[model samples]
Target: MILLLFLVSCNNGSGSEKIKAAVICTSPEAAKIGIDVLKKGGNAFDAAVAVGFAMAVAWPSAGNIGGGGFLVGRTAANEAFTIDYREKAPMLGFKDMFLDEKGEPVEDMSTYGYAASGVPGSVDGMWRFHQKYGSLPWKDLVQPAIDLAENGFEMTRDLASSLNYQAENLSKTPEAAAIFTKTGGFVIGDRLIQKNLANTLRKVAEQGRDGFYTGEVAEEIARSVEEKGGFIRLKDLEQYEAKFRDPIRFNYRGYEIISMPPPSSGGTALYAILKSFERYNPADYPYASAEYIQLFTEICRQVYADRSEFLGDPDFYEVPMQKLLSDEYISMITDQIKFADQHLTSEQVKPAKDLIAESTETTHWSIVDEKGNMVSNTTTLNGGYGAKVVAGSTGFLLNNEMDDFSIKPGVANMYGLLGNIANAIEPGKRMLSSMTPTLILKDGKPFMTVGSPGGSRIITIVAQAIIRVIDYNYSMNEAVNLARIHHQWLPDEIQFERGAMSFSVAEQLKSWGYELNRYSSYGDCHGILFKNDGNLQLGISTRSNGAAEWY
Candidate 1:
């Protein structure tokens, strides 16, 4: 098979400066796999499917088939769309599923073990994209992943470190333990292979979505959940389907910004942030200056407050989209950012009617083909080695995305973002997500595709990237590599990547009475910018083991 031949071939790229097609992913192997698909006469969609599956094998910490996500793409014909493959609550799930008899969240029920797993949508999602835009055979798109899983790949130091970090939890699940831990424990350079997962991928390749959502695979998932005292059933898997939705879009400084809509709070939050920022000219504030950072932080807090009060799955709840995105509303929020020396108290930035709105451990990749087709995809298992439970015999990690729901009305989820009833769990409902796979258009043509993986911070990182490129005229690399900060409203603290602000700037923010927290890194953003000259510029995060290659 062509896939096998490519698999055995040396992992080398032409590295031509004049290359047109390109792919940037959080895993080097996944990026190469995507480029291979592009090289084999596939379009951006085909390359996306290949990269999606390949990441599942090479970067299981966040990449996954047992989880779900969103895909935003612009076809060569200029049609833009978003596919919401986000995981759905199982049929047996309920608003209080995670709550104990005492009306408190049960310990670990919504974040760990079998009970946390939602009905996964990734396979169905990928298959749907292939049905619409793929040129390569479905099996061909999946073969590289099967080969990688069966034949094994060298464990990177990052993967080894991740394994060790999750070793205690992974040890609880025998299937996960066997695959992630060696006899002497996991180590860098070890040849990590998963025979069961390879077989699982083989079935998926041969049978398509049914290969995993029904028959043996489905039965195993149900049995595992039941055996572990959870509630998922085979019917949930049998009924799973990925939905196509209109991509949420807004004009930001004349650039059309496209992103996934609700069940993702990302689009609305992003739109709100960008629109609010439009009131202030970036040229007026030096980038990352204390004044600039303070203004950005204040606006972020307001936007996130709105998110907690209004964002939810439109299918299940009535999201006030028109009101939320109104020019008046944006201006109202923008007006809240006052003098740089002053900060808005949490009380001043109130949520609407006290109503509800809405991982750092996800994977995102950007792909652009020579034909003007582009894809921005963000997939996740909802935390590193999600749920710490492997479905029996499947060798895939199930997402703890149930934690994404409002287990308690005012309580925060794993990401520390609070939610209201609008985001509470319901049978067969998709939980709200922050996965913002975005594609920016210039004059109705693809200009940039970007996204990141950072729990609630995904929206902020993506928004910053857009501002860096469109407003500040930074190259794709500068946009992605620029230091970032996040303020999710409830925390009331500014979390900035170390060096994102200089010591003077940090101290200045502190002096202004803003709580500041620093981290070595925050999110991993991968992006591809299409230069007007018809060349592709790629940017992969420095905090990750990803790669950028074009040909």
Candidate 2:
């Protein structure tokens, strides 16, 4: 049986009726900041803005001012939209930037150091969203982040572990090393101050987008990149713009799913997977049963195969969105699943033109305000502490998002996914991404807001959560906490989270000729579900030091 997890309650000013404002973020401090914004009479958009800036301070592994991501939001009046803050390759970037004399990828060129950094869009993205939707003063939303950076916050065990894990890379850059490392190295419970970052945030609060993208901050970024042998110029920073696009909307079991569109492949892949399952009732197979797992794995494999061949930055490439999402296309693919079959060979599943394509290290937050406003955001630096390089005096890590592009066609990037021309590097192009920040609605009102950070696994994790909720009748907590499995159509293996399935189920899968891999955990999801009765429920992943706060 599923149990709904009710977070603390918040009352409207009159204290009569409960105001269902809630926030679930990757860190307690960030969540608290968001909730505080709600308490100050700000709406969900304001809370999201506050959380985005605060996460940059508290969760540096993926939450970063120097990085970029997407935001999916619904206004109190039922307006749905998306902001694409995804980072773009610098104008100097090229298809062969990562190649060597022999045309082989240069060692770590796409994943580390200055060359990996893209023109950051996080600041501009936030600014755009706030400009259109925020009710709070821009400076007010950023002040908490500035305060946290200046006075410092106690480093959590996870942050300490991440700092240590990336120590070697961090040590390579003086700016990064100075902020993360103490004489004795990073330690849990130690106060970590980012005075320089605090000053940078102050400028952003005072001057808005121009504060970060131009002037002193922009010059510092260029200097850091040039000093370390990179091509990003002040022009790249100045040209950066966060786009506002229509959110991809699809119907699943009568509920409307709103998600980020390309340059994020997440929404398309997710829609494909869910639509593939349209023919079957998940409850009939029993949750996590061998039968269900086998079917789920096959669908994942098919959807990802399509993702590699069909998805990319729409600005640069023509994505066959209508054809891919067509009922005919979904039926054609779903027909391939044979219930009695143990495995579907790659050869048996015909590839579209025989082409292939695309972090667990990212952050997500979900918020729903009292008046029915909703926001689902996923942000990243591409890798832990991103390129492990900080822009000189900026005191923030730079994103290695260039690595997200297919540096070598048909070859896997750092995330172990292959790609083709659709995602290849190009000047001024946004790299293809798998960040899926999604919102779901029932009867045209917000039902649930969900998103996670797990690189390619994000699409599957989110799809499975929705399946658990709508099909299996799991509550928000149960849906999020349920064990999960992922199959990305490559390597022909199914990776399952530890304890997600039973030993008997694994043995059964093997008997059916399937290869299985196990991991301790997968994605860290944060979610909010608005109940029919006007109450709210929240769930934060136990895998991370996240929190769910309401009121």
Candidate 3:
């Protein structure tokens, strides 16, 4: 790990351009896997595939083939694109799947068992990514994960603690218990192995997407879901396909920001917040000061208000992309923030007049290869360990992403953020998400790749990283490791990372009528800052366990 002090003196784009490529991710082992791929002639896309699959083995809490996510990248050729592999509700799924006979949400129905699992798309997504842009052999990229799963890797304190925390829930599923639980419980340095997961990875390496979506593995998943009274079935697995989508592109202070689009509110919400800050340079105000916090809070309030009302799966709902992102609309929202007397209460800041309703334990990794390929990917299984049920012998936990949808319009999902009809659950429809895999370009060259793992705080964490680097001129480490603050419209409170605010700033915010709440810590953001001199500066967050590798 690069010392924080060394990172402080490193000026982005101005340092000695010795480092050529870099990978920053949530786990040291995964980061090493990514760097190894780059060393072996793989491009950023290939390394992303390797790191992604490796994370599934080494960072199981949030990474898994049974889950799904989004990927945003700027190719070596300067093309920007996104892959939407977000999990979709199965054909058997219904709008009220989580509701009991009384029409009320059954407790834990959408977040704790096979009943909560959605049709996973990660394996398919990685396969598609490899097909489209990978330079390395598919099997070669996946072999590391298979090996890790088969041979086992030493457990870290964090991994041990996470498994223990979910011991009760994980033990409920026999398959999950056999793999995740130890005689007493996992401890640091213990070797964790999953032969079943290795076998699954081998099939994927051999047959690509078909290995998981069809045949034995798929059958096992479907059968387990059915036996457990869940909605997934063989048809859902057979029909699943990850898609390539045009990334949301917008200019912010001359830097072009590209991110995931609908079905993921991340890109849209990020743009709204960044665009609102365009007129006002945040560098003028001290970082984490009362003034800066208030400004950020107001913009987030307005943007999140819009998120609850107008964002969702474009395939299912007609999101007003153009209107919501228009100059007029952005100006109006910025005006509110610019001239605000106090924080806008949730009631005062409502969604635009008539919009079609259409939005965390998550994992993120940023990779930049020597050939100028940049990939920013964020994958997740909803809450930590997701649904806590492994597909019969698949040896991976299923995602509880069903909770991501607005099961009941006007109801808050697991993240405490309310959703509306636009985000209602539907058969084969992807749920709205806050996974913002994003990229930035300066002078048409890849500049930064960033994303985070925080249920609702992802957008804010990412936005703040960009702000700190571009506006405040902080180094990549400082940009990401700095304390973060988040505000989702409903709940109407400014969430400060425990030590995020000073006593003076906290007292000042309260004086301004803002309700403040302290969260231990949220995002585990990781990124690479492409220096002007052709170096790669990694911003691996210290807030959580992660590593940055460069060569």
Candidate 4:
């Protein structure tokens, strides 16, 4: 294990000028795995594959080897590819799963019970992306995770903290509790380790994914969930396949933004927000002032308003992709953002719902290689502990992402984001998501590598961070550490991160007629930009335990 860690830590890049390379991920273990890939002469895709699996073991709740997610990458040749491995509903799904006897939303059923899990796609997605663009073979890619799991990777402070925060929820399931608990639940600095999940990773490495999809592991998942009154079946497991799709690319002012399209409203909405911001400059007013915040929150409100009413699985819904991305609609939205002092009430939203607190179940990583390839990915299991159901002997969590759909209009989610008809529940469909993994380019060269893991706030933080770096002249790290502010539309209250916003700007926004609430933190963003000298400038947000390594 020590030898493997040493191998992962060593960086021996060669060739013309020793091309700069870096990878940003949630765990040091995962970053080390990425380094291993680079050591093996693997490109960014191969490194991403190695890090993806390693993160599954180190940051299980968000890493999601058994769940699903989205990935966008550009190859050394500058050709881009997108993989949509997001979880899908079982074919047995009923539209009324979220409705109660009185037709009111049964939120608890979707958030915590047996019916919450979706058919997983995480492994399939990683496998497919790696197979197509990676230098390492699939089995070789699985080897690192196998070693980490089999020998038991040490728990870090961040992992320990996250585990403790989820003790109550994780302890509910015997399988999860047995692994995460020792004595009185996981202590903040406890070393939580897993032999079963490691063994499972080992089996996949040697026997292939078939060892999971059609064998004993699948039985354990089905039996466990079935015992809990769930609907997961062998067919769901065997039929899982990751999808390859074209990414949405659009011009935002002078730069080009590439990101996941629909089924994910995050990138679309972010693109729209930036386009609108381009129409006006923060230079015109004091940055973070009340006036600036007023306009900022209002743009967020308008974009989320449309999301609640019209966003959904593109395959099942029209989504008006063209209409939403059109300059006309964006102009219309920007023109309506008023900074005058005022709180937007439910009455103000054409359609509305009583909102609630945000939910989390994801992690993100961004990387860039000297060869000019870039990767940004977001993976999740829908919430902490993920349906509180582990895949029995496999020790994998099932995603509750299915609850992201709107069973009824005017419904509030864990994120306080409103749900409506456009995002209605369906079988074999995906739920709306705010995992915005993005790449911004300038003059056909990589300028920024960025993304976030926050649920609904993912879009806001990424947008704000990019603006901070490119427009406000903040360094990559400063941009990420700067204070953040968010407004999720239906709630109609602006939530600001603990510090950094100018008091005068906030006061100006409040006086301009906005309702403000202060939060200890918002979504954290990580990014890297190319300096004119050709050196790499990367920043990881302090709000998260994320880190960036360059060589």
Highest TM-score against the true fold, candidate: 3
**Each prediction's whole-model lDDT (CA):** 0.86, 0.86, 0.87, 0.75
Summarize candidate 2's per-residue lDDT along 1-551 as a digit string, tens digits.
11113332332122234547888887778888998899899999999999999999989889989999999999979899999999999999999999999999999999999999998999999999999999999999999999999999988777888788778778886888899876657778998899999999999999999999999999999988988899899999998999999999999999999999999988888888888886788767788998888888888888887777677889999888887778877776777787655457765665554322128888899999888899999999988788988899999999999999989877788877778788888999999899999999999988999999898889989999888888888777767777899988886888998877899989988888888998778688877877777877676677765677775
- Shift in Å, residue 245, candidate 1: 0.2
Listed in order, each prediction's TM-score against the native is 0.95, 0.95, 0.96, 0.92
Clash tally for model 1: 6
Q: For model 1, what is the alpha-carbon lDDT of residue 58?
A: 92
Across 1-551, the per-residue lDDT of candidate 1 in tens digits comes to 11111211111212345658888887777778899889889999999999999999998888899999999999999999999999999999998988888999888888899999999999999999899889999999999999999999988888888888888889887888888766556778888888889889999999999999998998999999999987789999999999999999999999999999999988888898899888888878889899888878888888888888777778999998887878877777777677655768766777855323317899898899999999999999888888988899998888899999888888898889888888999999999989999999999888899999989999999999999988888877778877899888878889888778999988888888888988668677888887776666666677755576567
lDDT, candidate 3, 296-415, per-residue tens: 888899898889888889999999998888888888787766332455677888887653221158999888888888899999999999999999998989999999999997778889
Better of 2 and 3 by lDDT: 3
Give the C-alpha lDDT of model 4: 0.75
Model 1 quality (TM-score): 0.95
- Number of the top lDDT candidate: 3
Worst 10 residues of 4 by lDDT: 1-10
Off by over 4 Å in 4: 1-19, 342-346, 351-358
Candidate 2 overall lDDT versus native: 0.86
